[model samples]
Target: MIVNLTTLDQDQAIEQISQLEPQLFGTSAWSPNAIRQELNAPARTYWADIDPTTTPGNPVIRGYAGIWFDGYDTQIMTIGVAPQHQHHGIGQTLLQQIIDQATADHAERILLEVRVDNTPALTLYTKNGFTRIGLRKRYYQPEGIDAYTMALPLNPHTIGFQPTHA
Candidate 1:
């Protein structure tokens, strides 16, 4: 199930995303401090996909995503699914939620940067109507991997795209 993540969920989200970072992002993984700051940052929204069967008051986060909307454009900050949960449509669900949030906020567009070699992420973005806008060389630190900046225009009347409601 997908749920909005608040400061109350910070520690669990951090631990789960931290464990998945090495497998999902290599050296570009976000630090725990970074996650903490983002969770508390203004105009930022985060969501977590938790196992529905998990115990009450204790969730097992299968994946998590975040975005920042500054009253105009919405920028996807991060999206990661555990290796064990990959290919189960959790990423797609998270992306759709972000898109819905952006649209609801009347955002002009949504923007994100994906590592050049992350095929799965690229496919997910493109399939969701995000177009390649530019490239950032050496965007991922330490590993020095290139990144493709992508965007999705959100004017429904112009793009013929509609955000889904679950």
Candidate 2:
């Protein structure tokens, strides 16, 4: 089942991330230092797939998602599902979990930058109610590619926040 990403799972996440490095930041591989840096970043939230306690088949650590807080709003740091695990609703599941947390943290909105070339991920965010707010020129590092700025309004129901009168 899906759950919050853990500090103990850093090693496994790093290893898995290495395998998919080519997908992001272009063909240049990432260093262990980079992986550790990401895992230990301040004000970051991460979620991971775990070994199902009541099910069969190797859990294999499907994927992970993360976000960084910017005081006023939360910025989506990164989100990815293992290639074999794509299209199984894992992306949506991970995103939902993060959205829940962000809203709980009192974030008014969630923002992210995605490569314009990433059609599937863009579609996924769009389908999940994220709207394109603007464009960032050469936003993706190492690739010098533009990214679409996406924002998702956090509904109170999704994060269990109820307002009260003074």
Candidate 3:
């Protein structure tokens, strides 16, 4: 069950995501404070996939994703799934939800950076039509991992169309 995260889910989201950060992002995981700030940031949307079978009072976040949209462009901020829940389509679902939002918001394009070594993520993005646009050397920080800058152009007419005006 994918749901937009609310203020009430802040602490749980932070706690759960923090637990998965090291495994997902290596040395570049967001701190709890950073998560809090992002959640409060304007023009950003965050969502979580909750375990529907969990007890009513204790919803478990199986995966979470966030994106920042500033009218014309949407930038993916982060996406993480609990290690145990990965490979079960949670990440894909989160990705799709954000993409849907970007399309509905009239975004010209959506962009993101993924570690070059993250094959699963690269595959996921590529399968969804994102194309590599550039590379950011040593973008993953102290770990020194390179990143691939990828983009998905939402409006096909704007991205590759060269209109020959007669």
Clashes of each: 0, 1, 0
Ranked candidates, highest TM-score first: 3, 1, 2
Among these predictions, the greatest TM-score belongs to 3
lDDT of 3 by residue, 1-166 (tens): 9988884467887888788788888779888888889999999899989999998767888888999999889999999998999999998999999999999998989999999999999999999999999999999988889999999999755567687999
Q: Between the candidate structures 1 and 3, which one is better when assessed by TM-score?
A: 3
Greater-lDDT candidate between 1 and 2: 1
lDDT of 2 at 163: 83
Q: Model 1 misses residue 108 by how many Å?
A: 0.2
- Against the true structure, candidate 2 reaches a TM-score of 0.81
TM-score of each: 0.90, 0.81, 0.92
What's the true lDDT of residue 10 in model 1? 71
Residue 76 C-alpha lDDT in model 2: 90
Best by lDDT: 3
Q: How high is the lDDT of residue 43 in model 1?
A: 92
